[model samples]
Target chain A: MKQKNKKVNYSKWGYIFILPFFLTFFIFSFIPLVDTIRYSFFQYFRSGLKWIGPNFVGLENYKSLLQSDMLRYAGNTFILWIIGFVPQIVISLLLASWFVDARLKIKGQQFFKVVIYMPNLIMASAFAMLFFALFSLKGPINSILISWGVITETTPIDFMGTALGTRSLVGVMNFLMWFGNTTIMLMAAIMGISPDIFEASEIDGCNSFQRFFRITLPLIRPILAYTLITSIIGGLQMFDVPQILTNGAGSPNRTSYTLIMFLNDHLKSKNYGMAGALSVYLFVVSGILCYITYKITNDDDPDGSKAAARKRKKMERRMK
Target chain B: MESKGYNRFRVIFAHVLLIILSFLCLFFFYILIVNATRPHAEIQKGFSILPGGYLVTNFKNMISDGTYPIVSGVINSIIVAGCSAALCTYFSALTAYGLYAYDFKLKKVAFTFIMAILVMPTQVTAMGFLRLITKMNMDDTLFPLIIPSIASPAVFYFMYSYLQSSLPLSLVEAARIDGSREFRTFNQIVLPIMKPAMAVQAIFTFVGSWNNYFVPALVLETKSKMTVPVIIALLRGADYMNRDMGKMYMMIATAILPIIVVYLFLSKYIIAGVALGGVKG
Candidate 1:
């Protein structure tokens, strides 16, 4: 009885240990999240020194946002993410396969890995600034291009002036910043696969492309899915790079504008109602994306899925 | 014989591609560094592959300029990131240990809750967080930025998995038999065992906090309280365009130098940690 009592005492220590985390999380994160939702349904803003209404409204904030450029900004985000992610995934897969190919005996593997990943260490804001300096009207890139006669000194390319140019610059920067990390992750995933499987595939006369598509690609699907989901969430919250690059103006006609930048503008204007509504929108969208990815990627058990399908069919028959 | 030749050709092709890609990766950084050393007039003239002699001059110019509080920004960034790394690692470990060490009534519930919130992006809660900070009068302070480190779900997840693999419950039982207190056992025994995990997570958390711009930009109104990223943003403002280009580049260089230095020393661990984190997830 005493021994059991001591064990129970230890259980209370579990609560004690976790108490600080929960307390802080509840006060700082949980309450704020709830309050955000509360504010979303209200009319709240500050006009100069005077306080505006905290008056309750329906989904009026969300309704107005739909009428705004929110959908266009969302489209811009999707386009930017796609442009960056396509090249990123392709290059990462190529690099990972090459690095992991034991037969290749790639020299200085460690050196290559270290060099590639250095960009991920640097601050994104600093990175944006570097790009901004490099791609300015008389920036190094333009001057160099002119000197090399790639383009005449008469017409320097305005890299940040057009919609396509800005989006492409943004995409290229995202690709550079992330490809290294993605390559490293993919290499790890490929390495986790058993060597015997590769040996068997080679013995069966599988070419490099065949082996990758049939064996490596399918095996690493989970990691790929994980990467995609995280990248989607990250892309949705993309503000720092474009924000710094365009100096918060979203440039050339607001073509480079993003959803978070819009939300930030609302917050900057002290329009809490709109900002709160946007936050709730982002929350719901990300939650749905997370659920979809989780469901899609978690189909690791064929028999379990088959059983589920059978159960659904049985229910359908009974209903009939 | 044909296939053997084909394989050799493939190997050579792959090496060539890799070399080019690696060069592309480092080329912009090379340009940034080289330009940082050049005079503003020389920079305006054109790009140069060679390093210039004005590195110290650029540094001096950046310091003498009174536009932004560069010194205070660096100091504030260090304090916030350092405190965040420490609090995040210690509290995450403690939280993970609690879940791992005991089987209580709400154990599964708590575990699931943390995991569910793991994917909850901070951006989604920014509006509410801002409102909360204002109402609590914690605006313009480092407390909002640092205090939220206590409840980092991703770090908690990583630590929990690390404990599962590295720590044994039998050791806890043995320590208990020796009459060591619960907290002491955790601090003395578990923490040391978790040193590698903590170190890796510390680097990541520190870099994340340092690179963070959004939260700091919102919360910190005082120039003295602003972080490196925020200051760098201010330096990139339209008014600074007519300013000295060399100094601007130098400031940008300074902003990223600490992280670059840290990465150079700990590249192996940071790279390994990233792979490990992804795999575990």
Candidate 2:
């Protein structure tokens, strides 16, 4: 009885330890998300100083959002994401590989790393303002174009006034901010590969390309998967940059309008149900993306996963 | 060791590529610094190639002007960010300690529950969170900002793994044998072991909170209570304020300096082992 009591005390500490996280998460995150799910079914209306009810309105919010250009805004987000993410993946992958190359003799590698990640630490709103200024009419970019004879001073390109220009600016910002993070994560993954493996590959007369494809790529698949999924998630939720850039109007033909912007618009109009529905859609889409990432990345460990499963089963059997 | 001529060229080419990449990383920073020092008129005249002498004026104007309240914004940001970081690190580490050290009935359930929500973008929960905060009278207050960070699943996972990889049960046992209470064991023995992780995650949380705009934009309503990002947005959004381009640049430059300074001092520790447990969800 005393031993059991001691064990009970042991488990009590576990609960005590995790209580704060669960409590805070429940109050702030879980309840809110559950409430969002519930709110998706009801319409919100304000009543003077007191905000009124989430009266049940069934699937109307989802139907209305589907009937509108909300999907178009999603498309805009996808376009921005693609343009931004592709270069981000490619460039960061190259940098990651380069940084790890002992033969490269890259000087001040630490400085490059520190500088690259500096952007990530700064606020996105600050980036938006900085880019807005840089790309504004008669901004430095215009001056550079003029000097380079890319366009005459009289014909300085209006970057913010055009969809492609603004999208590209957004894309550039995403690339700049994220490329470093991806590089760091990927570099860590590459370095995690045992040096003996590299020595073994070299002993087999494997060329650099062979080493990358046969060893590095296979080894870093997990981090690659992680970065890809997170990048997609961040891209899908691209809000502050475009919103601030176009002053939240999604100007230049609403090209900057994203799902978050659309959702915010609904929220502004007190269309709480619609905002909830949009958030649910985002939630579902993210879940699906995560599933796909798991599928692809898990497949990379074809043998190891199965072997681990077997080991786990064996351990379970032994315990039983 | 002597290398072939072609291999030597490859090395040189790699250096050149690195230099180019580094330039790409540093380009905007250079532009921002130059723009911040230049006069408003010079900035408006299509960018001065060189730095002007208006940085002090721009800063002075920002300080004197109460409309933007750049100074208060910085203080509010520091408070919110600092509190969030402290709360996030300490509570997350505690939570991680719980999950890591114990074998409880709900351990797997708790783990899965938190991990499932880890990837759920905060935006999905924003509407409901704002409503709750408003109902609780936390809107326009920093409480919502600082409190939610306690449930940081990313920090939790990082610390959990850090503890798992480094901590030994025997250490805890030894402490218990030494007559230390459970809390004291954690505070004295476990905490010291988790210090490196706490520091790393503390910085991450700080930077994340400092730069976070979405939730703060929604929750923080008042002018004095606003964070740096919120203020920057308002100032940039105001059309007339646009004329003080140098001040705007200076504001941004100033906002990023503290973080850059922290990073410069801690870069060696930060970049190493940050992703040692990289495969986390």
Candidate 3:
């Protein structure tokens, strides 16, 4: 009984230590999330003062979201995600593989790592301005392209105006912004593999490429899956680059407008109901995509599963 | 002998490819710095590798007339980032200590809640959060920008994992037996040992807050209250055609300076933190 009391006292102190986070999380995160969903179903009126009253719209906002221009915005977001995320992962893996290769024998590899990582720290607004300077019709890139006679005076690249043009712009920006960070993460995962595996592969006369494909890729599959899912989720929700570069209207016929941008506009226009519905839509879509990605990438290790089952059976025997 | 020759050729090819890619990466940054120095006309006309003499003039123009409230924005950015980092570090550390020390029935549930919120993008609650701020009469203030970020679940998740690995329960028990209160034990005992984790969290929180554009843009409408990123956005928009090119370059340079300075100082912490955070997440 005395020991029980002491244990309770210890737990009480633990609770006391954690109370601040719980208080703040409840007030800031959980409450706002609940309020967001709740207010989506109501009519928010602002005649005298803002008031949220239950109107039982019965999925009116969600229904309207489906029929609204949001579908177009969603399509744009999907395109951006593919352009941004797919190439990002590929480039990252390629770079990581190259960095790990023995033949490169690169000096100051850490210096290169730092240089690539620096861009990710820059503000999106600054990056946008930098790109605007670089990609403008009269900018140096165009001048260089023209000087090389790649295009005649009659033809100029309108990088920020056309669908393909904006996609390329954002794609490049996303790649530059993300590739370094992804490379570092992948490098860490690669480094985690036991050196004995490499020795074994070499003993078997496996070449570097073959060893990487067979041993390295398979061993780091979980990490790759993790990176892919997070990148997809982040890419789908991209806003700052498009918002800043396109002046908040999503550039050249809204070709660059992501779903988040669309949602922001709805909120700014005081269509809170629609904004809430859109948020819910993004949440659901991202959740579903994450699920699908997890399912597709999941690998079943037969030996590992059998080992786990044997360990469980042994534990049960000890308990008995 | 033929295979040896082939291997040598492959090695050379790999090094050449790597060198080219490295140069490509360096070229973009070179463009940024060169553009910062050159006159807008020269920049528009063609690439110039050497530094020009327009940097001081640009700096003066940017300080005098640029849309960004450069000095005040810097101060506001520092305050917001500094306060948010301190608050987030303390709260997250405290939560992590509690969760790890106790064997409560709701431990799994509480942890799941933290993980769930970590993945939920702030955009999902932006509208409601905005309304909540307006209702509290806190709109357009730096308070809204700083206070809400203090409850970052990502930081809590980091702290949780860090505490599990680095902290032991014996220290807490010893402090308790010495008649130290829970808060005192945490402040005096736990915090000192958690410096590595704290440094990483602080750097991440500071850089994140410093680079944040969306929440600040939405919440702070007043020019005086604008954060650095928001000010940079405004400068980019304030007459792109007839804009003071010198001032524009200066604003861009100023906007990037703080982050670069901080990153230079805290890069070691940043890298370690990123590595650790990546492991658990």
Best by lDDT: 1
Candidate 1: where are CA atoms >4 Å away? Answer: A1-8, A292-320
Q: List the residue pairs that clash in candidate 1.
A: none
- Native-vs-model 3 lDDT? 0.76
Model 3 CA deviation exceeding 4 Å by range: A1-8, A43-55, A101-104, A152-155, A287-320, B1-14, B40-46
How good is the docking of model 1, by CAPRI class? medium
Every model's TM-score: 0.95, 0.93, 0.90
Q: Give the better candidate number (2 or 3) by lDDT.
A: 2
lDDT of 3 at A233: 80
Residue B18 error for model 3, in Å? 3.8
Looking at model 3, give its docking quality level. medium
TM-score for chain B in model 2: 0.94
lDDT per residue (tens digit) for residues A1-320 in model 2 = 22464643577888999999999988998888998899999887564567667689899888988999988999999998898899888878878887887877677888888877777777888888888888888778889888889999788889999899889998988888888888888988898789999888778887777887888998887678778887888888899899888899888999889888887777656667878998899889988876665455435454388779889999999999
Q: Over the full model, what C-alpha lDDT does candidate 2 score relative to the true structure?
A: 0.83
- Residue by residue across A12-71, what tens digits does model 3's lDDT show? 766676677787767776677777887677665343455555476868888877887888
lDDT of 1 by residue, B41-85 (tens): 888888898999999999888877666878788889999999999
Superior by lDDT: candidate 1 or candidate 2: 1
Off by over 4 Å in 2: A1-8, A46-53, A290-320, B1-3, B240-242, B277-281
Interface RMSD of each: 2.0, 2.7, 3.1
Query: What does candidate 3's lDDT look like per residue over B21-126, in tens digits?
Result: 5676567667767667777676655767687888887776666663567878888999999999999998888888888877666777876666655656777878
